[model samples]
Target: MTDLVLRPMTPQDLGDVLALQAKGYPAALHDSAEAFLSRMALAPTLNLVAHDGGGLRGYLVSHPWAAGSPPPVDSVLPTAAPQDCWYVHDLSVAEAARGLGLARRLLIAGRDAAQALGLTRSELIAVEGAAPFWRRQGWSLPAIIAPELAAKAAGYGSSAVFMACEDIAAL
Candidate 1:
């Protein structure tokens, strides 16, 4: 693999991101390309893309939790103040990009961005058999998941595990 370049997601990159998401999580429903593009534009910095010379290889999308919002368990809700928590909505690496550590790099980038913005914690929903992978990356399953999120994740035939890391340094 050539040197991987990481950059903020652009509107033009929506198709590629959605395609990768479909491929990476065939069993899970995802945001439409339009929705992804809109969110990316609104929070470009939090929507990161990693690319090799070939094309987009991986990406991670995150958003801060709403003020006074209970811990995220289902869909993310917008917050008024810059919440101390950052939620990792999605992270996917192309099949060809696997084993290259692109996912880890993207994750670290997200964590760094969150920390740079003064977020004290980072969280994500681990789907399918990804629990072990998140654990290896220093994320631990929390005691409970939000009820709303649990039902939403069930549609994907998997329960969402709440995982958290103390700081970007932990990545």
Candidate 2:
């Protein structure tokens, strides 16, 4: 973990980001280069990468989005990002780097960027049984979810959980 650096995600980093995705995420969770580029265009500052001088260790891809309506997985976002809340679209850490706290560090950095933009909340659809991990990070499931929203989340995976943190600045 020594020499690990957290920096704004750049276009040049997409190839490594995609490689990290293939290793760290389920095949179904993979998003295309077009999708990644769209988010980077929408909120470049909110997207981040962690590199340990060797290679990419982790990444956090987020953007301003409407709360309760997560964009579909692997799809490109709208030209203009909705400024409602911070939407954490993806967070992945290299298997070898998992125990070094890279994921949490990337998350905190993304949250700080969102807060600076005046976003008070954050939302994410946790796939692959990641809800518990997110819960530990201060995210919670809403008491009620719209049927349509639930269906959309199902597109992510049967186990997808739409979670949110109401007070972004607090964490």
Candidate 3:
């Protein structure tokens, strides 16, 4: 395996990141290159790219969310203490990079970023197929989810679990 470097994603890397997302996830979650570039410009630090010697290998995008609020579908929620919580929006590792802990590394990097911002917790909506993985990583379902988020997640069926990690180290 090649050495991996984690860096803030740039506009130039958007296409590669979108391609990787398409390869890793279904169309529903794959954003267009323009959309991703826009996101990178809006929240550069949270848009992280993992690169090996060849090119982009993986990427993760996390945004802070307000406690007791619905997950924002089009924008990050306004918060008095934005650092208190983080929402892991998307995490994707190239097929070639799977099973090598690259996803874990990207998630850990997001956790560190959240900690640096003074966040005490991190949250994500895990699809049914991802629940086991999140559980293994020390995340648990929260007691309540915002109605809007719940509605948005209806398509995921009843098995989708909203998981959170209170400690970055635990992840």
Best-matching candidate per TM-score: 2
**Weakest 10 consecutive residues, lDDT, candidate 3?**
72-81
Q: Model 3, range 47-158, lDDT digits (tens) per residue? A: 7999988888899987666644425333433333334577776788888888999888888888887777667687777764788888887788777777766665654445
Q: Which of the two candidates, 1 or 3, achieves a greater TM-score against the reference? A: 1
lDDT of 1 by residue, 46-68 (tens): 88999888999988887665422
TM-scores for every predicted model: 0.82, 0.97, 0.81
RMSD of each: 3.2, 0.9, 3.1
The lDDT of model 3 is: 0.71
Residue 143, candidate 1: alpha-carbon lDDT? 71
lDDT of each: 0.71, 0.91, 0.71
Measured by lDDT, the strongest candidate is 2
In the range 105-149, model 2's lDDT, one tens digit per residue, is 999999999988899999999999999999989899999999998
Task: Name the runs in model 1 displaced over 4 angstroms.
Answer: 67-82, 144-156
> How much does candidate 3 score in TM-score?
0.81
Error of 1 at 28 (Å): 3.7
